[model samples]
Target chain A: MRDSCSRELTCIARSDPRIIILSGDIGNHMFDGFKAEFPDRFYNCGVAEANMISVAAGLALSGYRPFVYTFAAFDLTRCYEQVRIDVCFQNLPVVIIGLGGGLTYAPLGPTHYICEDISILRCLPNMTIVCPADQAEVMASLRSSLDHHGPMYIRINKKNEPCIYTGEPDFSLGRAQLIQDGNDVCIITTGVLLSEVIRAARILEERNISACVVHFHTIKPVDEIMLREVFSRFSVVVSVEEHTLPGGLGGMIAEWMIDNRIKSSDLIRIGTGDYFLTHCLSQKEARDHFGISADLIAGKIADGLNK
Target chain B: MALAAKISGNKYRSFVLMSDGECNEGTVWEAVLLAPVQKLGNLIFIVDNNGWQATGRCDDIMHLNPLADKFKTFGWNSFEVDGHNFEELLNIFHSIPVDSEKPTAIIAHTVKGKGVSFMEGDNNWHYRIPTADDVTRAKAELGLE
Candidate 1:
């Protein structure tokens, strides 16, 4: 997904002269094509994420579209003040590309794992959060970011993520993409976890339980129309994500359901617990440990249907 | 912004006015180290050296002495001037891009509160709000009676 983002950014910069890339001393080789082609547009702002964010805000204020790229853990948490004040406060057009979203860097330990990015960013005004499911979604989101008016946070996985879309599906900001149609249950997911959710849906289908799969690439400004439709149509709606349960997609859906008084369906949130994982594990192992793996999600959905 | 102008081939310049105490933040030095490498000649940073921070004197708190020399060491074209003097400020502003390939930094020596007898150089004014009588006296001190 990160590689796809770089490629798409380079493609976008070819036509948009206002496009500028700012990195926090990362992605040196990944952005080589962009730098070679548009030398003046790429800026490696050194190991200073805060300064990079502020500089991006300044560039945005001056009619330039600046994309600040760095690790998901450091990009938002490390320079949160800069994003809130310099970028979101003024509602600038700065696209913050957060690489290694969720537990993609699980082998690197908890410092690199970012499960709270969606939680923190969703509360800020003028801040839009988009967690693309795969390389296709990453490319689409990057393309959509060019026209997005306010500050946007694009959370992406590292690499070799399974492609959920065979072809480029019709993509837009703040709209959920329906991957499959079913009636018994709906599995709503965001980010790379969509692959796991799809697998779970297929598993449920084999058990004679029809499960719908919806991909919520955009967490904030959620697809309310889809939410209303899913909650009204399905008896059990499950939200699965690689992030923590609080203030993530699941939490956001829960709030939306309550505010709209949609009591027809029971929402089951599948994600990491409140605590961080102390043990070192691989991404797959970490997902299993957090009960967000395919098998566990399918089992949870089946149990919800039985109840 | 200066880098944006340079990349887009614009003649516009960008100025950032900061307080002396704000220099204590690590991000300030992070930007200080970067602007020179980018050769952002259109960028100018003005530091209002008021000699005091929130709790105590700036030097006593962080020891940012030789601040101008610090920017010079970091590859910026550094300058100093009396912040209160209009002519000095105008002269420094007119001489931007001192090296034509380096960012400019001006250390403007200033009092905490200028043009007022009671509030000048008083760090208490950083957070304290003046009473009505104090405001009247302040106005009188500034010859606004």
Candidate 2:
């Protein structure tokens, strides 16, 4: 995910000189290629995320589209106020890319975990949240972010993630892609959890319990039209995500369903409970422990549908 | 970049006003170092040195004594003035000090709640807005009657 984003940034800077890269002092070595290509456009703000956010906002207000990159812990939660007041409130064109989102840094403990970024950022107006599932989606989301005139957040994992899309499938903003079609239950997933949700869908397929899989890379605008259509048609809708339950993808869908008065037989939310995972574990282990892995998701969905 | 790019695009300089309580944030200092490194003379900042924070006095919460000295240490031209004085503010804003190599930080000494007799030097008014009667008494004190 980092490779795809950094390489894309270099290409972007060549065409658009107004696109500046501001780092929170972590990605200087990784962005060496970017620095070599466009030396004047890159800045390292030391380990100061709040300062980076304000500086990015200042740059954005001056007609430059600044991309601020840092780990999710410092990027979203630490500098939330600056992002809210300086970037979001002012409606600046700043792309905030948070690496190691969710449990990608699970080995580092809860301080590095980022289960609440989507929830917190979505609360601010003029903030668009995108959790790209793969390389292609990352590329598409980066390009689409340029077209947006306000603050956009792109959450990514730490290392090499397998590409889910065989080819770039008409990636557009505010539109969820329908990965598979079925009727028993609809699984709406976001971020890195798309891969697991896809696996869960396959398991349900083997059981002859068809499940519709919709992948939402953009979590804020959230393809509400398609979501409405899916919710009204499907009796059972299951929302999957790598975030906490309250204001994550599940809560978003619940809001839409409740507002539209679309009554489902069951709306199962597959995510973390209302507490932090306060232990050392790998990303997969954490997912399994939290009952958000593919097997657990499939089991929960199958059980709910069968009942 | 905001300085060079924006200053190039138009005919305006940026002025920022913030509170001394906000100095607890490390990012404020990071930005402080950048202003001079980038040589943004067009950017002028006014720090409201009210000496009070959310919980207690700023000095009790964090070590921010001699606020003007701290700005100078960050390579900025720092000065202190009566924040309530309109003329003093106008005089400082009128011209940048000669031989100034960096951005100017004006540390404006102020009270948390000024003008109102009851709320002055009190921390409660910092969190709570003035009630209707509070405003009435304040108006009388300021000779608005």
- Residues A1-307, candidate 2: write the lDDT tens digits: 8888999988878888899998765663578899888888988765557878999999998889999998888888888899999999999999999998888988888888878889998889999999999988888899888888889999999777767999875789888899899988999999888899989889888888899999988898878888877877888999988899989999988887788777754688989878887788899999998899988999999999873
Clashes of each: 0, 0
* Most accurate candidate by DockQ: 2
DockQ by candidate, in order? 0.02, 0.05
Candidate 1 contains a number of clashing pairs equal to: 0
Interface RMSD of each: 12.6, 10.9
lDDT of 2: 0.85
lDDT of each: 0.88, 0.85
Sorted into a CAPRI-style docking class, model 1 comes out as incorrect
Give the local distance difference test score of model 1.
0.88
